[model samples]
Structures are given as C-alpha cells and as structure tokens.
Target: MRVADVGEFGLIERVTSRLTYGPATLLGPGDDAAVIAAPDARVAASTDVLVEGRHFRRDWGSARDIGHRAAAANLADIAAMGGTPTALLVALCMPPELEQSWAEELADGLAAEAATVGASVVGGDMSSSPTLTIAVTALGDLGGRPPVTRSGARPGDVLALAGRTGYAAAGLTVLSRGFRTPRLLVEAYRRPEVPYAAGPQAAGLGATSMIDVSDGLVADLGHVARASGVAIDVRRDAFEVPPQMRDAAQALGADPYAWMLGGGEDHALAATFPPGVDLPPPWRPIGLVAAGSGVTVDGKPYTGSAGWDHFR
Candidate 1:
C-alpha cells in the first residue's frame, strides 16, 4: 500500500514502533519532543539532507540502503565533532505515491545503523512532497571532552586518517558506466561505511582537528586547511587503492588516484594530532600540517574539481 492509504499519523506510528530506544533516551517518539541524556552538559548536533535524484537514486539503491546512507552521513558529522552519537531525528518527506513498505525498510536501515553507535530514532515528522527527501539530525555526547573542530589544527601537526576512502566514488563511476565490480565496491557506493568508534577515540587521544571525508579527501581537507589557516600536504605515495577499486578503475580506464583524492561520501575520519603522537589502529598518518594555506597533493596545489558542490 501507498503512504496515502495510511495517512500521516499512521505512517509515523508504523516507523516509530519499529525503532527501539536505549538508556540514553528519557522520552522517545509519540511525544512533542525527545528528552535524551546529556552527561557532558553539552550536545553536539549535525543535520544532513538526502534528496532523490541528487543525493541518491531509487533505482540505484533500496530504501534500506538510502536510509542507512542518510544515517551514516549525519552520524559521521557528529563523529567529526568528537562526540558519540546518542540519537537521531529523521524527517522524511515523500510523495503520496510512495510505498508504505519502502518507508518501513528505511526505518529498519536507520535503526540498524543507529544501533551500531548505540543511538535510536527519537522522533521525526512526515509530510507529503512532490519528491523524496530525508533529513536526519544527529545528537551526540562529548563525554566532557572538548569538541575537535576543523579549526584546531596547528602547524607541525600530523594528519591521520581512520577508515577507507575513495571506494564510494569509484563505485559511483562503476554504476554510472554500467560496469560491474566487486559486490563490496557497489555496496560502498550505496551504503558508505562510517567508522563510528574512531571518532571518540581520536578525541580521547587529543585530536587537534578532525573532519569527516564526506566530500572527497582534498575538498574536505580544504575545509580544514581554510579553517585552521594551515597548509595540508598529503603524501601521494601513502595511498593504496583497494584492490577492488583498482580493478574497477582498470575497467573504466579511470584514474584511481582521482577517486582517492576527489571521491566523497566515504565518511572516513581525517584528523590531526600533535607531531610525534602515536596513532592507534585504523588511524594512519597521511600527511602533515604546515604554515601557509590551502591543500596540496604531494606538495603541489590540486587543480581538479573540489568534490561535490550542491550548486554549480
């Protein structure tokens, strides 16, 4: 059945009933607002919107895949701030012709991803629209630690990355070209992986600055470089394209390095720690912060397009 058959409130109930809240929730859905625990006495919040034919394509992914991608994107934002996600408020806008089962599957994907970080969907709003849009607001706890913002990096800091990159962008190319690669690469494009634990770990280890690689490595790092007023030099030799992406690149005759440098939506954490500080697992130094400005690939300015821009 379509969403129009059940109406607004019924659809809300169906989605909310499927989600399970944790101890962090004081009050969940079926309420005016959710009351969640704020042990740090401060909250880190980030919101992201996924629009059909823009952020995702229905034909390219399932409702569950879209839902998980949406959740991962927002959760990574909280992680970028050095906070542990506590809850999410998902606002779904769909056309009346949208199927009810699709909404249910989307909720399942959201809850599944939230459960990984011990978070849940507290509440949200549903409305009819001419197209599909999902807006997710994530709430996180800093655990009494100061947030790790993009502006905190200093000269002489070591740039490290936690989690893989470029796989999603390669996957997108594979899909666009109608080429087939490994299942993982395609799935990476559909539901990018977000290293949830690495966020708080970086904060605990005193990360000077951190940001998620949502809009390609160089583009996102450009934000850090611009914000911190420092130059970031990424080592070209330090990158090793995943074997699957390498094969896909070969098939498409695409530059794997471009995928690594220009790919986005991987949601990997890129952080800077003080020089000589030892990085933990999944965190490896890829570059260094230095005086000056802008981002450089192997000590040279990157001239390619800087990741995704909503307009233009």
Candidate 2:
C-alpha cells in the first residue's frame, strides 16, 4: 500500500510501533517532543540531511540503506565530539505514492543502526514532498569529559585514524561504472561501518582534536588545520590498500589513493594525540601535526580535489 493510503498518523503508528527506546529517552513517540536524559549536564547534538538523487538514489540502495546512512552521518558527528549517542530524531519527507512498506523498512534501518551504539529513535515528523528527504538529529552524552574539538591539535601532535577509509568511495566508483560484482565494495557504499566507540576512546586517550571523515580525510583534516592553526601531513605509505579496493580501482582505471584520501562518508574518526602516546587497536598513527596551516600529503598539497564540495 502507498503511504497516502494510510495517512500521516497511520504511518507514524506503523513506524513507531516497532521502535525500542534507550535509557536516555524519557519520552519517545506519541509526544510533543522527546525528553532525553542528560546526566552529564551537557549534551552533544548533531544534525544531517539526505536528499534523494543528490545524496542518494533509490536504484542504488534500499530505503533501509538510506535510513542507516542518514542516521550514521549524524551519530558519527556526536561521536566525533567525544560523546556517546543516546537518541535520534528523524524527519522524513516523501512522495505520496511512496510505498508504505518502504517507510517502515526505513524506520527499521534507523532503529537498527541506533541500537548499535545503544541509542534509540525517540521522535520524528513526516511530510509529503516531491522528493524524498531524511533529516536526523542525534543527541549524545559527554560522560563529563570536555569535547574533543577541531581547534585543540598542536604542533608535534600525532595524527591518528580509528577506522577504515576509502572503502565506501571505492564502492561508489564500482557502482557508478554500472558494475556490482564486488559485493563488498557496493555494500560499503550502501552502509558504512562507523567506529562509534573510537570517538570516546580517543577522548580518553587524550585526543587533542578530532573529526569524522565524512568529507574526505584531507578535506576534513583541513578543517582541523585551520581551526587549530596547525598543519597536518598525512603519510602516503601509512594506508594499507585492501585487495578489494586495489582490484576495483584497477578495473575502473582509477587511483585508489584518490578515493582513500578524498572520499567521504566512511565516518572514520581522525584524531590527533600528543607525542609518545600509545594508540590502541584500530587507532594507528597516520600522520603528524606541525606549526603551520593547511593539510598536505607526504609534505605536499594534494593534487586532486581534496574532497566533496556540495557547491562545487
């Protein structure tokens, strides 16, 4: 049945009926607004929007895949701030003819992803539109620690990474070329495996600065460089190119490093630490911070487009 057949309230009931709440959610759906607990006396919040065709394509992914991507985009932001995600507010705009089952699946996807970090879908809104759009707001608790902002990195700091990068970008390339034999790459593009725990872990380990790798490693690090008044130099040899990525790149006649350095949406946490600090598993030293401005690769500015630019 189409969403229009059920009307607004019916759709809401169908979506919320299966959702599970976390400890932080005092009031969930069927309320004016969600009341979430903030035991730390502070909350870290982030919001993101995904538009059909522009940010996603229905042919490329299922409604659930889009839902997971939208939630991860915002949740990872909260994690980047050294907080634990507690709740999510999702607002969806879809065409009247959109399938009712599609919306239900989308809600399931959002709930499943949130559950990974012990978070919940507390509340949301629905609207009819010509295009499909999903907007998510994620709330997090800092656990009484100061947020790891982008401006905290200092010269001589160790630039570290806590998750895999470029896999999604490589997957995107494979999909764009009308090929999907590499199921792994295609899946990565559809649903990123975000290292949500690494954010707070890095904060505990004294991360001077941190950011989620959404807009590409070099571009996002450029934000850190400008904010902290420092320069970041990423080592080209630091990345271990997976065989799958290499095979996809070779098939597409593309440089895998370009995707690794410039691809976005993997949601990997990039952080900087003080010298002599020991990085835990999954947190590896990938670069260095210096007394300068801007991001570089192997001591030089990256030649290609550094990352995604919506306007460009």
**For residues 33-73, could you state the per-residue lDDT of candidate 1 as single tens digits?**
99999997999999999989888888788999888999999
lDDT of each: 0.91, 0.92
Per-residue accuracy of model 2 over 1-312 as CA lDDT, tens digit each: 999999999999999999999898999999899999998899999989888878888888888897888888999999999999999999999999999999999999899999999999999999999999999999999999999999999999999998878988888888778888588778888999999999999999999999999999999999999999999999999998988888888889999999889999899999999999999978999999999899999999999668887766
Q: What clash pairs does model 1 have?
A: 216-263, 216-264
TM-score of 2: 0.99
lDDT at position 131, candidate 1: 86
List clashing residue pairs in candidate 2: none
User: Model 2, stretches more than 4 Å misplaced?
Assistant: none
The number of the candidate with the highest TM-score is 2
Residue 268 in candidate 1, Cα distance off native in Å = 0.4
Please provide TM-scores, in order, for all candidate models, with all chains considered together: 0.98, 0.99
